[model samples]
Target chain A: MKHNPYAALPATVENIIVETSNITTFTFRPEEPIPFKAGQFVELSIPGFGEAPFTPSSSPAVNDVMDITIMRVGAVTERIHALSKGDTVGIRGPLGQPYPLDKFKGKEILIVGGGVGLAPLRALFFALAEEMDHYKKIILRYGARSPGDIVYRNDVATAWGKPKVDLMLSVDKGDEGWKGNIGVVTTILEKNKLSINIQNSVAVVCGPPIMMKFATIKLLERGYAPENIYLSMEKNMSCGIGKCGHCRIGPYYACKDGPVFTYDRIKDEPRIWD
Target chain B: MAKQLKQGCTINGVIEFLTTGCRVYALSQTDSNYHLTSDEKWESDRHMLGPHRPVEPLKSILFPPRQGVGRLLEDAPHSSPKPAAVIGVKNCDLASLKIHDYVFRDTEPKDPYYIDLRNNTLIISCDCSRPCDVCFCTAVGDQPFPESGFDINISPLPNNQYVLESGSEKGKKALDSCSDLLEEASQDAMKARDTARKAVYKTVEEQAAVKGLDGNKNYQNAVTGSIESHLWERFAEDCVECGACNFVCCTCHCFLLADGRSATGTSERVKQWDSCLYKNFARVAGGANPRKYRAERLYNRFDKKFNFFKKVLNIYACDGCGRCIEACTGKIDIRDVLKEALDEA
Candidate 1:
């Protein structure tokens, strides 16, 4: 029913929590709680500045407060880094159609994320973790360029230590103290033998496009159906609604129609591997 | 009542009749091209509604290129101005505007800025007596003559009086306001208006007779086998990726919502147009562009037009509006490219 694409209501910047050297978790309290599904993102606006789409790193269950982990890469993010705890910002969305969570129920779910792409998937991880009894298996394979690039390291590590989640952390290159998996994330998927069955499971992946492209092929090799493989897309979105055609991949608006789509849905689109 | 205007008739009289003090827009020629200009300057009797295909669209006045979104700014407080009569909008532009409305003002609303502008504007469509070579509305189920969606439509008659027809409440209001300009209806006046309008339609139809894709059915599946064709590479090579095609395109509405930081300590989120043809349009956080090659970008552009838009909106992305063909610096005709792709496939 809500139609305005650029309507980012005023939100208060609760605090700026540091995640990695480049990435930080921005906590904000909106005028009203923007309750959204785990995989959905909001267009965060810095009034007089600009807006960018971000998924809340915090759990969707915690409605009162929200956290968006941002990697300072562009102008809007640079301004976001300079803002203080009490600064005022704006937010529109919980936009785009969220991931089809109900369909994933009772299936073995695999979450593979790379670097800052884990921010959006983090919400999914927490949402699934909240209702751990519903799904059969929750396997999270998270990787970064290096140990420092990893986000939510402590929380994810602590979650990995738990019996409910089978969480694995890997880095492309690891230091002496890293002692964890040292290789590409796809290698971990290939080497490790788990109870991952493709027929009844959906693999949700978000990361660099090359990583996703290769990771998708790897998942397909492991018997994951093309339709069963869900991909959270990151494109050039200006209006988090269908109005601005910038984020359109084929006919689908990355903002309104999807930031999340199945492998079969977008497999035909050219240059998705880049 | 719609009526035709004479060669020597003053446009001010038409404006006075169209708007009893309400704002009205008219097409005037500037630098030899017809633009959707207002009444401040209407010197030449030679140009009526200019010619056709203005430098910009009537949509620009209704929906400006850039405006603030999200929370409204104090200094630039967002105001939906009262609907003014937009006169002399050609049929091609009108058809393109329909597509824009479908994207921005459909069942799912887009920007409130667009809605406000659209809500306030009264469209007065005119029949293009002279359509250009690139005009192809007839192929896309639209004629050069005004169809539905106008508040009021006009047809120029041989006599000094113009035949006016009301299409909506706004049209009736405008006519009622200008009652002093009206005369009793006569059979000869009606016949003259119809005759002139028919002649304009015939001229436009003859000029726009090009082979167009079928309107009722979807041609997306027909394009599936053409993906691997070398035509994509050939077209990509010529494309400088300057983004003129996408920017000038009526249906290419890609935009980026940027948060602007003013030196005045005010932060604003402004939504500006963007193009997928750009290198970094699809680059994510880790600096990876999915559409790395120009070939892929070109394919994506055509795919959006031929394949994607049809899949979602049940309408082919391209409406046979030839703005992209005319605007491209590479001189790439999408129609020819699409035809080649289909043929080679």
Candidate 2:
């Protein structure tokens, strides 16, 4: 009998964190720890509902438990929002290419995340933080629709906003009580006047298609090379092992070749933003 | 080894002889087209088992439309079909097995079910002596004759005789089983088979030329360059999205997996055929759809067959079987579309 790649490992919801009105973070303890690099994703399934691919938001260094931040969207995510602690779900991956942390060892690493796009970046952030002395510098520029929509509030305010890392947060329209930057995340890069050493730096971007498009243009204008920009692409990933052919971008199978790809690699791919 | 089935032996007699050791499926005439039928429908002289491809592709027999996969309940037993012989398979249909091999067997983590069916089924391919109006096998780097990928290929000759050529060890074994009904191919029979093959190739070439499809155009390059062509929208406007084209296609193998729970709480995962034409094929979370337009979906089907499969598998997915043209509800001919796209490119 051939090995069925669709089989899911049973996992129990260990904890739940409500990040916003529409978004929640579920921490699961599987029967076994799913070892994966920072940007890889897993196909999470609630038995009655269906499966969807998600990147773990927690550090890859953490064993036994994984954190998946999900925004309530469509059927599967809506069902996931109704799930509580101790609920049983299925997980099938840790598939796709991960962030090339080895390449950024001696270079400055800049991450730009918009909305829940920060989920994967949070994992990369912690993974990089573990090897703090290896990289030159680490920076994050994150944005959300509003002050209420920010994810990982406690972690961003306490753990991730340390002196060793430069953390910049922004909202499209800030509330009256908000005291942080009041424009898009790209604007924070300009307003803060952060000295980004483009020659020796690499930028990882993940967000809405429009945000990523504009952010990429901004990065290119700032003298960052095209090959140095990494993108976390989100397509309709059915089988996380690349057999389904749903997540194809030109000649690349996004599930296997990448959910993570350098900008130069995919510049010629058609309808990438779409 | 080459052999000859005697002129007096009826098609039903040969089928009966073959079926004594294995189940046999052959073409039986339906109201509109020919379908693969077993002993109950097989007739000696009633059915015309030659000259055209069948309505249902050979892929349906190998990789079924739907099958239960993964763990099953103790009460439910999955029994694979016994070893069988498939006769009257056209050369165009046989060509697609090469692509299916690349997909289901040669790929990593090979599909055991497909491999099992492939191992058990004996393919008896038939050469197309009379090309159909829509047939264009020559246009896609193939002739209306089987070169390989079959256990036995039957080239028809005059006076009810057939030139049988064994292509594999299984074929030679099957031929050896029925050695009493066969004889060594005479020089006259050999010349007749060669003449028949050349005649069929000429007719297929003539039909393709008359349809303006006989050209050395690079379909992969044409489809790659025609991604932005407006012709796709024009052609796709009439599409009803019934997905008959994909269903009838021999190479389209996209599938969807779903879990069905029984009354006893045992869950079974079932694999079902899926089509790219479906609106939700490319829809992701948060209501984002990449190929939302009907034109884009239509273009994707051709693009996958000509461009993507060629780039990945080193073979174009389409073998010019023309089943898609015959099965289309909107009468959208792939040949015309391909020709127009190549011309524009």
Candidate 3:
């Protein structure tokens, strides 16, 4: 029998982690292992509640379980946020192209993220750490609304807390006891805390459209080539396939050609920030 | 295999033959629109061949407006339906089908539902012997005849007679099966068919030339250049968000999948047609809307048809059937919009 392309494999929520007030991460164990490289997305469906496209927040190396970090934003997401451990859902994916790790082999990598945009970056981070010695160094600059809004707080600080890794973090605002950077994530980039060879470095950015807009400008000003700057773009991707024309950005379908794209490739397209 | 002529075959005979094993839906002209109907007999007095494409797209029949794709909790619920034959299809509609074929068939992880229905369905197309006032197919580098992508083609002669030519083996068999109702096409009828084709092309070509739509065939450059133009703002002034243009358009394929409960109380995921003109079409979660303005949505529709598809498929998605011109209550003419947008500084 020909397989149903829209049929999502049944999955059970194995674990749940509260990242922030609105954002939470759910680890799901599906009927079949959903193997995906970093930067790829999946359609997560709640039974009878509809589906939404989300990037798997877990490492591709992990075979049995996949992680999805979601924010309570829309109707389907509201139900997904209400899901607890042992709750059954659906998953259809390993869709879209993964981040081209092959191109970043000998280059210094700058990973920048904002808000819950850190989810897909978290997956890419794990993939990059698995092969730490292959690259020169890793510079990660992440920002959120406030200190409390930071995701994977413990992991972000300690996971790559090695000699070659410079994990710089900031927030839009700070609480009383906050001692790290107290400005937007771009402020950290302005400080240039880490010594990155701009000519030999490729920057990967993900976040809200506003942050991505400024971060891209900041990266370009910092002598990074447009081709070297990677972005994880998001729009309303209903089918998670090219058939649906919803997530179209210029000639490329965000669902098919990319949720991940280079700044140079799409700079001339209209309304990049929007 | 030769052009087994069906000289005096009436549309009734063709519809009668097509309705044998499968269902048949032939286009019946209402006062203003052309819609497919499955009545026992079609309009005999009116010309059998279409002057242009019907306002209702062929996508509505092949892909369906709304259908259950699969179940939310249970096994895959619905199966693809039995084959059905559609008649009164114009060349513009056939061009629209090519875009659908590329999207649903040539793209990755082929749509099983679309593939099943299209594979089983036979296409019986007709040439547009006359151009509708709104039609500009010749302006956009497309002819008023079916060059390919059909089982059989019916070129109309005077007196409601048709010269049936088979495009596929199935069409040949269909003609052979209805041999009793047909005769060899005469030399006069063949010559008349060629004359009618040129006449219609001339009419549309002249209209396009007068409106300056013929030379500005490079739509990609026009739309991309005027991304920030004020013309879209003016075009969207009288717009009510009815999305009739999308519904009438032959190549618009945006869809939304919503979970709904069926009559049996079983929940299913239904794929339904969606329009980019709506406020929420490209809106994502967390309230960030890319196309929040009506002007942006309006521009997006043109950009997809003229620029996006041209860059990807090397063909403009608009076949210039001009169904959108009649369907829009706002009275927005697409030809005028393209002409003005192309000339916009």
Top TM-score prediction, candidate number: 3
lDDT of 1 by residue, B1-345 (tens): 454344455445755556544465777666756766654333335335544666565656655666665443333455556656677777666766666787777747555677777777777777666666676655445666676677777655554456666678877787666656554446787787668767766665565445444333334654666788888888888888888887666666666766666567666666666777888877764566767888878887877776766677666656555777777888887766766765766
Better DockQ candidate (1, 2) = 1
lDDT of 2 by residue, B274-340 (tens): 8888888887877778789999999889888888888898777888888899889999999888987
Model 2 scores a TM of 0.93
Q: Candidate 3 residues B89-179, lDDT tens each?
A: 8888888887899988888888888888887777888888667788888878788888678888888767776777878888778877777
Model 3 chain B is weakest, by summed lDDT over 10 consecutive residues, at: B39-48
Model 1 interface CAPRI class: medium
TM-score of each: 0.87, 0.93, 0.95
Q: What is the C-alpha lDDT of each candidate?
A: 0.72, 0.83, 0.84
For model 2 chain B, give the 10-residue run with minimal summed lDDT. B69-78
Candidate 1 stretches with Cα past 4 Å from truth are: A1-4, A12-17, A82-84, B1-15, B30-32, B40-47, B70-76, B159-161, B176-227, B230-251, B261-265, B295-299, B316-327, B333-342
Q: Which stretches of candidate 2 lie over 4 Å from their true place?
A: B6-23, B38-49, B71-81, B262-265
**Candidate 3: where are CA atoms >4 Å away?**
B1-11, B39-51, B78-80, B176-186
Query: How good is the docking of model 3, by CAPRI class?
Result: medium
Candidate 3: C-alpha RMSD to true structure equals 2.2
- The full ranking of all candidates by TM-score, starting with the best, is 3, 2, 1
